[model samples]
Target: MPRIKTILMAGTALASVLVLTPSPAAAQSTTKPKAEEQQEAETSTAKADRETLLDTITISATMINEAVFDSLSATSYVGDKDLERIQANTPADIFKTTPGVGASMNGDDPATAINIRGLQQYGRVVVTLDGARQDYWRVGHGSGSFYIEPDLLKAVTVIRGPVSNAYGSGGIGGLVAFETKDAGDFLNADEQYAISEKIAYESNGEGFTTSTTAAIRPHQAFDIIGNVNWRDRDAYEDGHGDEVRWTGEEVTSGYGKATFRPAQGHEIKLGAIIQRYEDYVTGSSGSTSATLSRYDADTINNTYTAKYTYFDPDDRLLDYAFTAYHNKTKAEQTQVWPTSSIGNFRYYDVRTTGISGHNSSRFDWMGLAHTLTYGGDYYYLEGESSASHFGQGEAQAYGGFLQWMGHYSSWLELIAAIRYDGYHLDGETKGTTTTPPEDESLDGDQVSPRFTVGVTPFTGFQLFGGYSEGYRAPGLQDVFRGSGAHDTADGYIPNFGLKPEVAKSWEGGVNLKYDGILTESDILRGKFTGFYTKVYDYIETDFTITPRMTDNIGTARLQGVEAELIYDLGWGFINLTGALIDAELIDTDNPKYKGQPLENAPLDKFSATVGFRAFEDQLIFGGQYLAVGEVKRTQRSSGTNPGQVDGPAQYSDAFELVNLFANWIVSENLKIDLAVENLFDVAYTDPQSAWSYTSDVEQGKGRTFKIGVTTRFGG
Candidate 1:
């Protein structure tokens, strides 16, 4: 009876969505009659043509918004069109098309870990949603991970290195920032209200997704938007027709935001998001026990943010912003042990609160135009767990930064920045029969510096280079978390004296933007870059010791080259991306693991795609091919160490995959999308997934067909 009622309610909602929608003709007829319509149409088309030739603007690399072509560091932007083509359901799905990035999926929870330039875990990479930090970490057997529903994202931007120290601390690897949809994304210039609905399904997991959005502009000064989504999925089958356990999940999310413009040059935004996930996993965050316990888990994430901005074209000194945010994540698990005599329930929770203020000041000095940016921030993070064997702790960070951009001429630009970051940690341990009880505290601070120079040597060609230093402070999990102990004497131990990690990085790159190279309508945009990074006081567990313990493992280095190219032939587009990375532990205290390859680094990767637009830009089709090189396992420094350490590293072979997608706009009010992943049904494993302690290889998702439809009304 409950299932029946659910089905009935779903049917009613769908019916309401369709019935409330306005006709295509009504939506298009915004002005009275056909008067002035032709002029408006011509203006819109001209605006689009101009925008197509202009560079994309992004702010993830720095607090100030500027063109990507002008950026001093490597940056990638994912807009709405890219998300639609991939039929992205999770953050992992979207990142498959992005270069220099990888996602690790552990167990059933769809949220994946973000890896940039072969570095991840322990705050090395910072992930933010609408300027609020997504600092959820389980300290599990795999990488540190967080979850965010893709339906709420309007755009995603990535910075590949630590050139952006002004944003915050602990982003030595990079940063991924997600922007939520706003009222302007849906509402038409002349419309007062708008509604949009979307539905999607996938064949592999038999997943179904439904989402609805509403936007309203009640007055000239105020606007608001609201969104809700629901999804259900089952375990998916691999390429070999085998089911992957714990690969399914149920999710629901809600978001709402409002913007107010009280007066010219003043704006205020308030927003909130709530999401929940229900799934099953095998073990706790810090341990993968041999007992093979099954846990039914419920996870929740909630975030709220408020931002105020003041900007005026005539006032160069008042381009300023202030923001405050709070985020919370909770995970509850009910464990079912093989020995049914005992059952256990545990929970892990983390909360983060932060505030930031910044401003950009523009001035002219010595015949050069300059923009100076300065900012400061404070964040307080706390976490706790219910399990007796798990450790709990808290931390606080305060930081400030200053940056200066000098444009001597149209051909030469220079940038310099410095940041001071300080953090303090309070760690606690709950002792068991086999473990000791203790409480400890630690604190550290660092000053990071960066410099860059960009020059337009010739028309349509630009060259840039930079050097930077990144710093990451130890978090609670890295210092307090412990692996459970059994009857054996080799149980994991906690480390109270962990040191912070520091990275020195350098990069040189060339960007080319050429139009009319082949024909009047032809266009090409290309970027090629080479980067090297060395990390000091790298942190790793001392696996060679009995009952592994954390320690500073000396130094590690990664050097790589990345290339991207896109060409438009008036009717279609072709794109290519390639990367080659060498990562190793160059120096370490453990003699057994020195000069070994990193556990989850792929040496080489390449991908290519081609797409065409036809039928007056109403229909589009595209296909992509991806190839990855083999990854080597971490080896002991010497062969004389005791054998059989817990969760030894393993290697994976090279693999290739193919995908195809198509999109059609049936009418002004409706659109459809289709995608087929792993088109050849090839059996492969991703390096990120290979980190599972239980298996040497985790099978990647196989061939799957996805279809989606979107409808808009009352705009």
Candidate 2:
């Protein structure tokens, strides 16, 4: 508590000093000539055209809309053009080149789990669609997963690390914000309506996808958009030309949005999304044994949202936005393999409802341009499972935050924020003869603070640094799980007294933006970041004792460096991204096992992409190369029995892949795309995948060819 108070005080004091400082630019602001200002605006527009990447604005980092390149924290943006160029088939594909980000997915399941800076699962990383949180969890051999169709999204913004604490609670690792497509994305300014149809096919999986989108502007104040997509795929062969079982599935999804403008400054948007998946999944996600359990699974997800905003240039005090949303995810499975459990049914469901609102007021304070923002958010989650060992529970979280952003002399900027978060969890566990049924509950609260400063010492370069804190409450499963036979050697004991995890992070970075560096029409933009984070009360499963239980393990330290760079000339572009990370678990009761590398940590990765435009920008082609480092892990033997081998050491070999893509604009209403993935047909496994085991790492898809065609028309 004292530490929290000290941080708050320091932040407030720093903000005051920065805002009160006088600057020459502020005093001379009114003296700038109109002709010079106009020239500056034109120069900005010309620069935007030259930069092929990160041309979009991002609102996830500081809640203030700004270009990703200008953000002080490590942030990445994927716009509609990037999405179209990638032709992503899964959520993982969308982030292939993003630094410090890794995704793990089971071979048979469409769900995905994201890892950031070696931290993942149980709300360490927050995923949101249209500002609605996706809270779904199921007990398995790997990390928890979420479902989202990449086709429905128009943009994705990623904010890495706890600097995003103001966005919400429990995002100690990072935040991934997804923005769905709307009427504005498809309809032109002068068009009243429009329709688009797209069809795509893949060779390796024999996959096919059909999509249709329609947008209409019935009145000057109202607009509506709808889209439907269906996709099907067969089991795909690996590089060895052997089929990977349960790798195929069918998916259907639909989305709709209606926007209303009742007043000049007020707007409202109502949206709905639905997705259904049918496939065969395995009981043990990563296991390679032939006798592993198999199940026929059907999953459905739905989300509804309403958002309202009021923004008027004349009213600086009323730049306000509010959103309310509800989401539900349900899955049904029937055991089909493993004779003993054949015909058994399992069901899982989770419902999340949340509301968030914020208002920003801008004004000049003490010769500085300042913005003060305040907001509060609340969310409730309920989950239930038919599996005996999986617990049923309810959880609620609420938080409020206040932030101040100040700018001086067009060269210096400062940001300070404080947030308070509280959570309550309650659940019941199935008990055995040795342990009676018990109802458990827990509650906790914390205050976290953040501060950042940036200085542009030169015209095209900036140096920035910040310190932030984040909090994550324990999950319901961690507190309520209590189903095990006490007499048996294999059992899990429930620990209701578990503590929440807290993260303190420090980050520094440099941003570079230059135009006409080498040629008359060339651009270069890049950001390099280094970060270190220490987590207190890190939670993990403890196997040192009989009746293994979940507990607060100890402190964890993670440090890493990430880099992203893009260079664009008129005819061609080059993009590069890479990350190097090191992490360890420390302060453990067992000294011999201390300082071991954390399990499931992603390996070092680097990517490079080069592309060229031809035929007056109508034809575009590109190729990408990715390299991943190797990882090796040795399982620790049981403490009770010394020198006993628990399992073989896990190892994943280093690998490289190359891909090529092309897009051709045939006419105003027609376009075509082609891509080849894994061009060399390399046989390798992703390091952090659920199917990556010591004996047999799941083989990635072999060389695959994809093609798509789209036609659009409007009246």
State how far residue 356 of model 1 sits from its true place (Å): 1.3
Global Cα lDDT for candidate 2: 0.82
Q: In model 1, which runs have C-alpha deviations exceeding 4 angstroms?
A: 1-54, 284-291, 337-342, 388-390, 429-438, 485-490, 635-649, 691-698
Clashes of each: 7, 0
lDDT of 2 at 572: 86
TM-score of each: 0.89, 0.91
lDDT of 1: 0.77
Q: What is the per-residue lDDT of model 2 for residues 373-450, given as tens digits with 9 covering 90 to 100?
A: 999999999989987556569999999999999999889999999999999998865577797777778999999999
| Residue 117, model 2: Cα distance from true site in angstroms | 0.4
Candidate 2, run of 10 with poorest lDDT: 1-10
Candidate 1 lDDT over residue span 620-705, tens digit each: 89899877777767643222343333235566777778999999998979999999999998877676663343442236778999
